[model samples]
Target: MRKLALSDEILLKVEKPARYIGNEVNSVMKDKEKVDIRFAMCFPDVYEIGMSHLGIQILYDMFNRREDVWCERVYSPWTDLDKIMREEKIPLFALESQDPIKEFDFLGITLQYEMCYTNILQILDLSQIPLFAKDRSEEDPIVIGGGPCAVNPEPIADFFDLFYVGEGETQYDALLEAYKENRRCGGSRKDFLQMAAKIEGIYVPQFYDAVYNEDGTLKSFVPNDPHAKEKIRRQVVVDMDKVSYPTKPVVPFIKVTQDRVVLEVMRGCIRGCRFCQAGMIYRPTREKNLETLKKYASEMLKSTGHEEISLSSLSSSDFSELKGIVTYLIDEFKGKGINISLPSLRIDAFSLDVMSKVQDIRKSSLTFAPEAGSQRMRNVINKGLTEEMILEGAGKAFEGGWNKVKLYFMLGLPTETEEDMKEIPRLADKVARRYYEIPKDKRNGKCQITFSTSFFIPKPFTPFQWAKMYTMDEYIHRAHVVNQEMKEQLNRKSLKYNWHEADVTVLEGVFARGDRRTSKVLLEAYRLGCLFDSWSEQFDNKKWMQAFENTGTDIAFYTMRERGKKELFPWDFIDAGVTKSFLYREWERAMRGEVTPNCREKCSACGAMCYEGGVCFEGKN
Candidate 1:
């Protein structure tokens, strides 16, 4: 039996002791002596939140399938346990074997959100490994990072030995093979990294150098090593049918954020929203075969015994065979106590019809992400949603018996005006009015319409990458403009309004567009007791501000200024299959308040056609 990493006395004192214990169902265990490679996969968040992530699960299953490899899972210890472990001087351990992560061959951390940057440092500190990649020797595990944030890895470049540039499925086999081969030949850690740098989709940050101008802009970025490519090409899996999917995922001991079976209906999005990084980075939308989804859905449900199943994708509605899969799920699991969850759907009659069958109307609420209040603002962001369409969709949903509705919007978008800010509540009021238009006897009750606004942060590889961000006070003022307008509406009592914290948004904006110079500030912030910054109750804005002051870093230099078209960006060396010229053209169109058509409507020749698959070659011979 594997011994618990923590003592019984310590486990009883902390909240959620199960988080630290191993031996969950379906978790892989192997003899350390027999396996040639030991991999520790981590999501730098709490166990519940990390377990809910599908990306890590897929990679875990894929890696463990190899006879010579043994993969395990790790998560950032909750604050209660974190203090205990530090006091006890216990090194962080992976869940499956309860062995110290320092014993592993590789430590792969997923970078899903910018707020979790401090937690990355926490992981390294607890594992008793060197925080900086340069301080490590061959005895330490090779710390690597990947996922959406890897598209802009410069901000945390010094902490990681290497970064996987794109989708994991396509290039991981070669990377693992190279690692084994290098070890067999008795190569040093640096020698192995040099060999790995030559593989596609792998980035060795130590081998690269960044130059800055006097104006605090990127002067140039170049590779110092001959093996490193001038531009790291993002790997894309054209044949989704051949990719691995985890049917038997590990079941958590406690309920999680997403305690359900998940089936990915597709990859990428056809919608070209200018401010969305996922839409741009995951281009040339590719989808799985309907039969493949059906098989995975049934297998995953049976293996986990989950009552709910969610269709995962950037935009579920854009899946060409959506109706076929939804119909199949409803018909097959209708009375079997299985619930189907379909998110990211564009509200339409077809969607309403399908949702009405699967969801309980009284318990569920309809959601619409118009992203902007005014149609003009929507066009500016290329949201492609109209007022008439929103009202019509709300009316249909109300008639279908869903009285609770949620409206999502973003503040601080380019070209936003006072009128645009005020229009957000007015739009929600219009939807509320549409609901009340139905007869009182036919309605469920007083309709509750909730509208939420989050401050927008520009991300890399998107059209808004060069846009200027507002200060915390400015973002709050924009939210206040919308709140004051809500008071004047006729349906004021029926509507509720909420906005996200501006402090986190400000920090996230700085990190998103930040360069290599920002690493020192990040290091200082982590040292100043800034872990779990993403949690509202634990976040300390003063500590972060002091860290910036301590490191001589100017927040305005990263967030408050706009970039010139000719200015070089820190992420310029990444070839995400979308050309810089194309992004600039879209930025120009956004400034003109002209809406660009989605990928299905027309091809703008954005350079995603280089993939030569998916929607890019849909009509070509």
Candidate 2:
């Protein structure tokens, strides 16, 4: 496939022109003639957002670092661009070289969010690749996936030939290097996948066969190769500071989420929230040094002309040297127009102070994630947060002259009761009091509070893996309960209660924890115009319901039926680091309202670091 050189007029006629053009400072440009394998790192989204993602940059750096491999970027063009590409008969092309994606040896997509599922399919079709793995011939580009979503790669399992279960920092290069050798031997894609599967952390879904029971529940998944490791240990890179990272983030032609240099201060979470797939999948937390971070940020800003920099991680507050990093960013970027944003902030006084220090007092809104309303429920989920601590943080926020607070919670957790449901407003009222207590001069005086709750979704590798989630009716009723309770106490005008319609999150939980049986419903949903179901505008509950009804599978089978500890999860054949016993023990502790200290504080012995020859804690095995 020849590269279609889009005229300046045509490139502008599509959408964000950044999607096509390349050659930013520090962007990889290897000799296509010398490279043995060319990879198109396709993000199933647009350019601005894709350029902002740090993982894409890291993998881009990792692959292109190998002289034998040249990795380029591919993104889903916007609706207007897609139409134009189809009309112009133009194939999807990579950013750096303006080469057609069809010419690449490998095509990898970051399956970051479930919402991007259809977009992934669209990219494949646009790239002129087969949508289903089975339909593709051996000569087709080897399609693979990575990210937290890949842990339960069931819904899209039929699409990707390989799924990288955990960290890709080190394993990505090893897999490519191995593939390069095999390519020289003229090996088939299957042989390449088989060999790649042998690399730690890569799961070749094709090597395993899934079986289901009569009720459409996942019965078991059997690996065709007995010698194949059932559990894929998550790939961990020791000394995260030394890993290949994008020193100069891609400068976007338009605004994006971060649109700036992103430096990963850390990887993994120490606060083990059971509902979080990333927390479990990214075990044994690791961090980058403050000096290296400063250098990266300095270099990136100077090279890319970025205005804002972000410290990327699952939870930024968990960084032991967070105080120093925050202090450094504040001191450095204060005079310049540069701003630093931290995602995944844990709720606490110290973390709040960090937020307050870096952000302008008036412009910043307090964001808190209780996850659950009541303490008992929080304990059951091992949130490691107390009502008192959250209220204390709220008081500090109010004292800081903030007028609004956005609180996040989850409904439909196991063992949830009406009492727990009422706590949502009870907690909100406490925060409201703190707001009113502010002195008249500080008060511009009107205070607003928003309590938003999302329906809980059980995921793979968490303690709740075997737990049954709430039904739709129960979820809706509970959401209403919190809303009514809050409405009655606070002025309806002063408080805003927002809850997600159970339709999407419930289905998210259903498919996320579901097995190969879900493939039928997924296909039916797609056939029934459920494509782009992630979009609020396009998601149709009626179509999804019909699809499920056609498959003779009720929502309860996926969302409400609790499996026993002994039963095999449909994804059992696919391992996401951290042992089952560790999750079970954590589950037991949660049931008794027990608290497991953070990994940095003490090693919980989840068996996450046994293979690493040392414990991941500060200093223990």
What are the C-alpha RMSDs, in order, of all predicted structures?
1.6, 3.0
Cα lDDT, model 2, residue 130: 88
lDDT of each residue in 1-621, candidate 1, tens digit only = 889888899899988989989788888889989999999999999999999999999999999999899999999999988998898899999999999999999999999999999999999999999999999999999999999999999999999999998999999989999999999999999998999899988999999999888988888899999999998988888778998999999999998999999999888888899999999998878889999999999999888889999999999998899999999999899789999999999999999999999999989999999999999999999998899999999999999989999999999999899999999999999999999999888898889999999999999999999899999999999999999999999999999999999999999999998888899988999999999999999999999999999999999999989889999999989988788999999999999999888878777778874323244452211
Model 2 TM-score (2 dp): 0.92
**lDDT of candidate 1?**
0.92
lDDT of 2 by residue, 1-621 (tens): 434457777876765676667766677777799988999998787676677777888888777768888898888777777778878888888877887777788999997877677678778877888878878887678899987788778778888888887767777778877887887898887778778878888887778887767766667776787535677766667677767777755676667777677878887787788888888777767778889888888888898887777788888877777888888888887689888777678757787677776677677677889988888998888888898888878877777667888888988887888999989888887788777777878774678888899988888889888788877888889988997788777555667888997878778887787666667777777667565566687578899889899988777877778877777776676556677888888777776777777766666777665213223443223
Model 1 steric clash pairs? none
Which candidate wins on lDDT?
1
* lDDT scores of the candidates, listed in order: 0.92, 0.78
Top candidate on TM-score is 1
Query: What's the residue-level lDDT of 165 in candidate 1?
Result: 89
Task: Report the error of model 1 at residue 376, Å.
Answer: 0.8
Candidate 2: give the clashing pairs: none
Query: What 10-residue stretch in candidate 2 is worst by lDDT?
Result: 611-620
